[model samples]
Target: MKKEFAVIGLGRFGGSICRALAEEGMEVMAIDVDEDRVNEFSMIASHAVVGDTTDESVIKSLGIRNFDHVIVAIGDNIQASILTTLILKELGVNKITVKAQNDYHEKVLRKIGADHVVHPERDMGRRIAHNISSNNVLDYLELSDEHSIVEIVANEKLSGHTLIDLDIRAKYGINIVAIKRRNDIIVSPLAHEEIQTNDILIVIGADVDIVRFEKKVMG
Candidate 1:
């Protein structure tokens, strides 16, 4: 059986999650305080409704606690977001993910029992900055303050060298987990496999190590 998901607050973030879940064939219930927003997703989501999520009665009457996971994506309204999350936690929802506007909001959400809290705007800003700063870097995902996964484009210096020949792990302390060539992807590439220029290397390691590897090898 497909897991059930509930997304409250039909703003850009919530709408995107609902659409993505529906695209993956999951049963998604989209909720919003705005009637127009709810109507927009009526056809895309398994269910769509408009109600104030801050009211515990509204949430319980809608059977929201039964969902496998619930996401609070309320925008701008910090009080509403916090209240909704608190209500969900009290209702014994198994998992509740909340979108926080800032670090202080995230801390409060965590204290109030949000299973996960995301600062999407701040994270996106960092990713954009990284991409623009390094021409060799195609993409960046921050896993922690110290660690990240980056996609780097191979240059002429790495055109013919194999993984073993470069000794990347020993020298740079980073791992090239996969290589993307044109439309194909090579996962856990073998040591003897030679790297081709223009290949996209998906590497993971501490942030400092990844930066060193990108500068030395992909420059």
Candidate 2:
């Protein structure tokens, strides 16, 4: 079955989610308090309406609880965001994801039963900083506060070494999950698979272990 999504807030983040969901052929309802913003998404979303989501009657009228997932993306106004999420939870929405302004906002949202909370700006900043700090780190994804998946470029130091020879999992407590060579990708690469210079290694491990592996092996 196609999952239905409702996005409350028509700012950049919410609008982007609407567009991506629409592109993926999902049914999406876009809502905003501003008529202009709602009108802008009229052709992009399955339905676009101008309404104050914080008002219980407004949300009930739209049948928002029917959506499989709801995203509270209200910008700047932390109070409104919390209120909207609370309303969604009260209405028995199955899953709710909220964009949090900061740590405090996130804590409040969690307490109010938000299924997921995201700090987009802060996360993007971290990704950019990681890329800037390391030449070998092609990309970084935070799986959690202490765990991450990183794409590291294999340098001369790591070339010709097999997984067994390096003892990656045993030594650094990290796993080389995949190897990307040219246009091809090898998932769950075997222990005997040899590393080639410039090969992109997709690794997963705790942050400390990943950092140690990068410095001792890739660096």
Candidate 3:
């Protein structure tokens, strides 16, 4: 079954998510206070409505609680975003995802019952900084505040070692979840799987442990 989602904002982040969800064949209800933004997404979304998200009656009237997921993406206006999130929670929305502008915003969202909070701008900046900082580090994703998943090229030092020999989980508290070589991808690689020089390792672990693993193994 196609999951139903409501994106409550028409700015870049919200609009992009609405478009992507619609493109993936999901039902997306796009909401915005701006009539122009609503009109722009009418053709792209399952439904588009112009309404003030901070109003509880507006949300209830639209039956927003029925959506499988609701995203509060109101930009710039922190008060509106927080109030909307609180209203959605009170209305019993199954899942609530909020776009937080900063750490303080994220904390507030979490306190108000947002199931998930994203800092898209900050995360993008971090990715860009990581890419510019190291040629070996291809990508970085924060699974949690302390945990992360990273993609790094296998250096010469790791060429012949198998996962069992390295004992990454025991020594570094990290797991080599997968390996990507050119066009090939090996998922949940076996303990005996040997590492080839230049192969990309997709690893997951605590951020500090990942750093240690990268320095000790990939360095």
Candidate 4:
């Protein structure tokens, strides 16, 4: 069954998520305090309403707790975000994801029962910086402070070697989870699979080990 989602705040982050969810055929309700913002998404969302989420009665009237998930993407207004999240939790929402403006806001959101908190701008900046800093690193996803999954382009130094020949897990403490070659993706590639130039290696491991592998093996 398709999960139902409610996105409060019709800003960039919330609007993007609402559009994507609708595109995937999921039922999505878009809400915002501004009439214009709600009108803008009227055609895009399954239901678009203008309402102040911070008001408990307004939230209750929308039957928000019935949705599988709720996303609080209120921008700039930290107080409104916190109040809405608290009300959602009090009303027994299954899951709540919130966008935090800063570290303090994230801490508060977690304390108040947010299922997930994201720092989109900060995370995107880090990904862009990682891609720019190393020619080998095509993309990066932070799993935690100490660990990450990175997409690395196989250079000449690594192109001719097989997984077993490289002994990468033993040497670098990282696993090549998948190999993207041309248009194909090999998930959990075999030990005998040989890497080729330009093949994208989706590697997961500790941050330090990944950096070491990038400098030594990818060179």
> Which is the winner by TM-score between candidate 1 and candidate 4?
4
Candidate 4 lDDT over residue span 1-219, tens digit each: 999999999899999999999999999999999999999999999999999999999999999999999999999999999999999999999999999999999999999999999998999998899899998898999987799999999998887899999999999899999999999999999999999999999999999999999998877
| Least well predicted 10-residue stretch by lDDT in candidate 4 | 136-145
Q: What local lDDT does model 2 show for residue 112?
A: 94
TM-scores of the candidates in the order shown:
0.94, 0.97, 0.95, 0.97
| Cα lDDT tens digits for candidate 1, 129-174 | 9999999998999998799999999999999999999999999999
Pairs with backbone N, CA or C atoms under 3 Å apart (clashes), candidate 3: none
Q: What is the lDDT of residue 70 in candidate 4?
A: 99
For 44-143, candidate 3 gives per-residue lDDT tens digits of 9999999998899999999999999999899999999999999999999999999999899999999989999999998888878866777689999988
lDDT per model vs. reference: 0.95, 0.95, 0.93, 0.96
Q: Which residue pairs clash within candidate 2?
A: none
